[model samples]
Target chain A: MNASTLWIFLPILTGALLLFLRNQRWVAFVAGGLSFLLALTAWLLPIETTLALGSYAFKLSSTFEILGRRLILTTNEQPILTLIYGAAAFWFIASPSVDKAHRLAPLGLVQVGVLVAALAVEPFLYAALLIEVAVLLTTPLLLSGRDKPGRGLLRFITFQTLAMPFILFTGWLLRGIEADPGASALIRQAAILLATGFVFLLAVFPFHTWIPLLSEETSPYLTGFVLWVFPTSALLFATGFVDRYAWIRTAPQLPQILSTVGALMVAGGGLMAAFQNNLGRIMGYAVILETGFSLLTLSLLKTQGIDLFFLLFVPRLLALALWALCLDILRQNAASLSLQDVRGLARPWPFASVGLIFAHLSMAGLPALAGFPIRLAILEDLATVSLSVAAWAFIGSVGLLAAAVRTIAILVAAPAELAWEARESWPQRLFIILGGLALFGLGAFPQWVLPLLNRLPAIFEHLGG
Target chain B: MLLNWLAGVLILMAGIGLFVSRDWRWNLGAMALQYLAAFWLVHASWPLAASAVKLITGWMACAALGMTLASARTEPGKEHGWRDGGFFRLLAAVLAGLVAFILATRLSAWLGIAPPIAWGSLTLMAVGLLLIGITTQPLRVILGLLTLLAGFEITYAAIESSELVTAAQSVITLGLALTGAYLLVAAKEETPQ
Candidate 1:
């Protein structure tokens, strides 16, 4: 396998060994160290290059046949693949605290599975099998210990599994059209099926209860991995179908459909999150809302939309990584994830809480944080379309921002009790510096990042302040 | 020629018998009859090579049944009725007929005959989804899921056949069934007499 393939699989290969390692600390250190090296390698790989399925050799730029179909990898995919795997590696490394408590091996395996699934051709169809494997993998995680499998995991699996047949049948139907191009009826059927399958998989509105339940049941770090990696991978994989099927991308009604669904998700999930008592659930809803925003951007059907999708993805991943890390470190002290439990938490763990607030604000798309730019860009794009469209985008942005404000309000409410003194850990301080540098870097010099994020889609590029 | 149709009718009848019969033994008999019908159907269609594979799968299934029966027999005789609420049985029966009829119609359509859209497959799928959606009873839902799956198989078989992907999909279904069975077995083990 070339570096791109190797970059994704290396951690997975090490995860197996992690299971056998007696010293959890060493497993954490080694796995993290190796993953960082791999991430660096991934970052260095030439963008938009394809590694043929049969040939291991690096083809700087070539498209060859695989099983009677062409599998092409372009420079556009390089940043995406690098960002996902590299970010995952960083999160896995930063999450040493949780790695000690839960078996990291299985979660790592699932992460790899999701990556492979996303990287695979026809992720729309392939995702079903991958999701099944993830469910199977989750069963052991869900069933771990004397703790009964919670309603959340059960619900998550049930909803996920139900979506499976839709995807498979959609694939089956779509496969038929290759031979019978005149089968317009069949094409429409496949599109509806595919759309529903994705809607269910992404836990789009009405199917979103599972996200909170799962986040609550699983370790925060693992939950963060699911929230960030899985959906992003699915979305990336979905882009392939959008790119491949002219009917889906070019359909006149498709963008409107996506926008409507997205608006509903944002409004519903945001409102729900605004009222939730549980922090994890709130984060879950926020992520769901963000997913909605992403969908809204995607519906624009421009390269700018894709770029915004990519740009929004980066900060969300970073924020969730920090969020999961904070939860992992603090879950031991809190009776529950309710704001009350976290009231005085910041006092004891100032750095972690600061990280949480930063992440939350970024999640909220506040200014100087990563979320702000993307949200603004999406809004600007919406304005060009219609006043009502811009209004809806504004409402969604407000909801996300409101959620963040609530979290900050809760944290600051009982600052004396919640504020945690920073530990003297040099490594943690280093991480804080890195996170701050990133936040500030993205914030102050929005210009430099805008070029990178602007490469997204035109809709987002126009929104760059 | 008539034997195939006869076997199909017998399987449908057995499925109905499973619904009406309160006795667990009778229900088992219906399942057994259904299995036999499946065996006959396979024998009538594919050559011995494919038949051999089906036969092996059948024998393995029989082994599982034997184990289930032996376990039940080993238990102390309680005055429990043989009835299984007949919910799954009824559901399964309705679904099987619906699926079979749908499959027949679709197969005819694919062969250039304009047969109607058999509502049977749709019914089977609907009932299966209902069973799975509403209930937490693993075994009942499993039976429902199996019925639903059978409906899918019929529709799929009518359209096209890629034995590899089909086999792969079947393996997944079987895996789900096995997981459900394990859950049932584990639950049975958990409860005290």
Candidate 2:
């Protein structure tokens, strides 16, 4: 079988199988590990090159076609696939700790398969439909056997569905632009539609209210997975558009618009996170800030911008995973994640509290954490363009830092009589410890992964780095 | 031409019926009529088989939702006697439909779309938006979403008539129906009997 079929179809088939074995936790672990191995094989195995195993020799092609459409997973996409499946494995392995092994493992695998399909689909417009399907899949996960689906889930579905028509319409209009490159009216219309669609998809500014609500209402682990997968895939999809169309990437106003939107998301999300009393909402704001940073990177000199964009990927994933794990652990003890509810939780769950603090601090771009190096790089780049913009971005970081400090204070405010104790299971403690180390390792030795990150821009031929 | 106009009238009636009615049974009937009208409209662009599939899947969706609602021991808000700001909502829906019709006419004129297709699609979209915006009920919102998708599909079929697109649209319709059913059941479970 081709790599596309192996990577995409295998996980999908596994996910389907998982649905039947939902009650068995071991199935989730085995299936999740096997899916990760498949993704890794796709990443490492060279396509169109023969491999010999004892007396057999075979080559795995990169392209797979079904129903007149094509899915191609070129070598350049290996890094991205590796990242996606790696994160999936991390989340899946940790699912049992959050009491979501059954639902998240099965459905999450399918969600990843469809999202990867979104990126690989030929004609790309079909990606819009695929994205809607993925969003539909997420509804069940978000509801999670609750008696009633929350308004947040409804809003999430509504906003995501609304983006589909705009994107599909944009694709239709783009044909007009392709036919007449000099047709200013058509180009303008396409641009507006495309930007509006991404705005909704990325949840920029006014469209982002659902982020905090969903994060607050759903399990932190599930919310983290959704937040990570949706925006990352959407950003990658948007990048594909910029890479494919010269007019879109070369639009003089494009960089300015991206920067403006990015700045707003950063400022708005950061400031809101600073005052938030709920830990889940804080995670939500952190995601918004990260998205804002990613957008701002797009405004940089194309090559540098694209490179910096990929740089944010691993750090953000690590920080979010750590944060969600801590939240889930604390949730086992506290009735709610509100500041009032989790106050003095540090006494009973010291490691988890530390993980929470560090994760938040990392997202806030504290020095010696995963998010700091990338945030610094982006800020430096922004300074070259506009120092005022850089200053504003820095202020946003400070807002998040302030929130982290407040959280730390609350966690440490236990009575003198209270004694510290390790409440987390061994596996949970191991995940948290490993996540914390990853944050520090990536921060301290970013060069180790810089080579891989630098290759990310190569996925887009015209987007030089 | 006469059949096209008839299809348009059926679509308009369905949109208006969905707006004015509160009972699930009546809404289901309106939805079925809307899908049938959609089949007729889509027949102009797609194959007869494709159009038939649309109608069948839509009816299937309606059946799934109908069964879910029927199985519930209580109807949504049965005690209130349809006291869900019915008059204002209907008035708002009518106004929205009128505005949407005017906009669709202008849009079609600009895009050079045929009148029947544009009118039916825009009317459905406007009414769907009205329902989704005004109602907090999951069933109503889901119906609105399905209506919106129906409208989008009409316009989309004019541009791309691929079987794949049709199949995808059918999946979206069924998916929305299943989600609506899930939400309806969940709501039922939540209610203290």
Candidate 3:
């Protein structure tokens, strides 16, 4: 079997099997362990090399074809696959602790498979359809058990679906632009259409309203997973566009536009996050700011920018997973996530509250945290581009920092008689502590992740390399 | 060509009907008519089998949504109604449809699209978007989504007539219908007897 089957199809098949399993805890452990193994194999297995097992040599090819379309997982994409599946494992393993493993694990695995397909599908435009399918799959997960689908879910699907036509139409227009490179007007039109499509997909600026709202309405863990997977894939897809089109890559205004939008997202998200009373909304805003940081990173002219972009990935994933897990854990203890509801939760759920604070702080790019190195690199890059842009980005980080401080203050605020205790289960505490240590470890030693990130830019020949 | 024009007219009428009416029966009837009209128009571009699939799936979606709405409460206030600001909404939809028609005409002409399909597609999309924008009612929003998808499919059919695209579109239509049904049931559960 090819790597595509092993990494993409196998997980999906496993997920399907998981649906029949009656025990939720078993589903969580199986899904988590399976995903972790897949991620390990993807990361460690060398493509185009034959391995001898008990005198039987087997080779896993990178390309798999279906109905004349190709799902190609080139050696360059190994890091990405590793990231996706690894993050899935992290989320799934923590899911049983929150009582959401059954529904989220099975569907989450399927969603990852489809998202991987979105990245690997040939003709590329077909990815739009695949993304729509993923979006639909997520609907049940988002709205499950709720009396009615929230406005957040509706808007989420609506906006996401709306992007499909724009992307498909852009693909159609691109054919014309490719036919005649000198067709400047057509090129301009295609650029506008393509930018608009990515804008919607990336939820840049005004389109980003759904993020905070969905975070407020949905389960934080599920929202975090959806938020993480979709935007990562969308960013990669956008990179694909820049890689494929010479005109787009060379367009004079493109970098400036990306930087402007990125700056706006960071500032806007950060500013909004500071005033939020809800932990979920704060997480939502942090995601928005991170997306903004990614856009800014992509806007950088040098390969270092691409390196920094990939550099941000591991930490962001870890931080978000930790944040979401903490929120979910606290949610079990408190009736609501608002400041008033969760006030003094730290006295009972010390680990959860601390995890929440640290995760938020790490996401804010605080010193000696996983997010710090990359955020600093991005700001440095922006400094060369425009000092004001750098300042705005910094301001955004400060906003998140303020929110984190507020969270800590609110969580720690209680009567002097209140006693500190670890209310979370042993497993939950272990994961939280490990996750926290990972944040500090990655922040302290950036070299470990740098090699993996360095190889990511190699995937995009023209845009990054 | 005459049949195509007739299909366009039916689509336009149904598009308007979806926006103007709040009654589930009327909305479902209009949605089915819109899909039927869409099949007729799409048939001009796609294979007979593909067009039939679109028609069947669209009808199934309508049936699914209709059945769900029927089983739930059908009282005037239980679902969305044309009670307050109905005239204003209707007026807004008409104005949006007009603007969309004009813009689509210009766009299609510039892009060398056939007029009949373009008009139908633009009208449906405009009306659907207006409905989605104005209403919070799950059923109405869902119908509007269906209308918009119908318009998108018509436009896409003119450009690409692949079976894969058609199949995907069918699945999306059905998915939308199921989601609408899910929402309706959820709403029913939420409403206290």
TM-score of each model's chain B: 0.60, 0.90, 0.88
Estimate every model's Cα lDDT from 0 to 1: 0.60, 0.85, 0.84
Which residue pairs clash within candidate 2? none
In model 1, the runs with Cα more than 4 Å from the true position are A1-13, A45-76, A100-102, A122-124, A179-182, A303-305, A412-437, A446-465, B1-124, B137-154, B157-171, B174-193
What is the clash count for each candidate, in the order shown?
Answer: 24, 0, 0
lDDT for model 1 comes to: 0.60
- Top candidate (DockQ): 2
Which stretches of model 2 miss by more than 4 angstroms? B76-84, B190-193
Give the winner by TM-score: 2
User: Which runs of model 3 end up more than 4 angstroms from their true locations?
Assistant: A48-50, A303-305, B73-83, B190-193
Task: Please write out the lDDT profile of model 1 over residues A51-139, one tens digit for every residue.
Answer: 55575656443243333333344444444545555675676565555543235543564456345543643333655655655554555
Reference-based TM-score of each model: 0.78, 0.97, 0.96
The total of clashing pairs for model 1 equals 24
What is the DockQ ranking, best to worst?
A: 2, 3, 1
